[model samples]
Target: MGVTEYSAKKLYAHLGFANGRDTMVAEGYRMDVLHVWGTHELSTADLLEWLGEFSPQSVEWIDDSSCTLRCNIIMINESTVLHVLHKLAEPFDRRVALTAMAAVISTMNTHNNGGDFERALRPPKLSPVEGTSDRLMPPCGRWFKSISSPERALCLYLRIAHKG
Candidate 1:
């Protein structure tokens, strides 16, 4: 599979941790896997440069095809993965960024019950004073209310998570 397909599958696998057993397994696991793929001309240095501040614990190259190269990056935590996703969004594919975001959100939800995941997914209750307009707001509207942008919200979340 290509980089995008690999990322999507990894995200789905992480989402499966919604089940108790999988969540427990994921909690016990200390490393996160990131797949990076490109033409054979792409080098490890290039990929690492693209990753920016997020450093991987290890990188394993898979030369499965003549024209393409794939690397499995072992990262320290979900936060590092989030950092990588943010970098990817800036220069790489936007879909990869969304996939990574969904994976991290799923991971956060599994770990914390009263986190942004709950707030983002919860349907907003219509305020009697405001009438039914509140119902029209998307579920994530409340989560993003205090944050000026999605990137800022992500940074804020990472900051809070790092503090604890």
Candidate 2:
């Protein structure tokens, strides 16, 4: 996607969307479309640099060439979302572009809910207690057999949820 120099300067000044830094308070945008078509060489370092510039919360690598960068839109607000969408518009088809708009609506809804959105997305953190994570036990057998009936059922549900 192409960003005009003027637009790039605006993003850089207001939102910290820079080419060389990881110290960003907000990642400028989220690309809803997963696939990048046409023959092009996108190096790993270049991809990582792009990710750093935008500063998404985390980047999930689909493969060497493809990755899903997730940003909690609630953190960036609507104007930045629109700016990113404007930048993304050139690379995507109409259908794919529409999905990005739809995501904006969903993200706004989550934003309206205050802390709930952030809490739901935060990964489970290990407590100060050492080896505490192991207490939950893995999804496999022998350990599964050791838990009480209710805990076992809860563990199974968690295992399925994790799989999804």
Candidate 3:
């Protein structure tokens, strides 16, 4: 719908994942999907497919330009997408940055947890994207996290997803 959403969606599609929402990260979730927590591994091609399809906008690609994305822990059905992805592939490890594999209880402090205008902490104490808590978060559980705010650059893609 928007430039950022288009970029995210483009990234997902490029990763070979079925279109999420005709946009970026907010795309719809397909029923045929399957995942395993740190066990089921996907090829780098598949992972790349999923990330490349997301629309790219407002981002400049450079040989060394990179951003560390922090996401909350997430669990869907029987697997942890982020964890497994990172565990299964060496490229994934470079793709994601968790800093730690364990969740810290202090992230829920609210006072310092993201504060009023800061980016959300990884393994978020409370992940509004997944509508769940990160009490026992792991490094590989970042896949299911996404902000739902349309105004936020990171969450803008989710806003265009199908309202399940």
After superposing candidate 1 on the true structure, give the runs of residues whose Cα lies further than 4 Å from its correct spot: 1-31, 64-71, 86-164
TM-score of each model, in listed order: 0.33, 0.25, 0.18
Candidate 1 lDDT over 65-154, as tens digits, reads 111111365566654653454434322233555689888878888998757777987788855655433333222200101122223122
lDDT for position 105 in model 2: 57
Q: At residue 48, what lDDT does model 3 achieve?
A: 33
TM-score for candidate 3, residues paired by index: 0.18
Clashing pairs in 1: none
* Winner by TM-score: 1
User: Which lDDT tens digits does candidate 2 get at residues 44-112?
Assistant: 343335434434343344433233333121112323333443443222123444578779757875767
- For candidate 2, give the lDDT of residue 162: 10
Q: How far is candidate 3 from the true structure (C-alpha RMSD, Å)?
A: 17.7
For candidate 2, the TM-score is 0.25
Looking at model 2, the pairs that clash are none
- Please provide the root mean square deviation of candidate 2 (C-alpha atoms, Å): 19.4
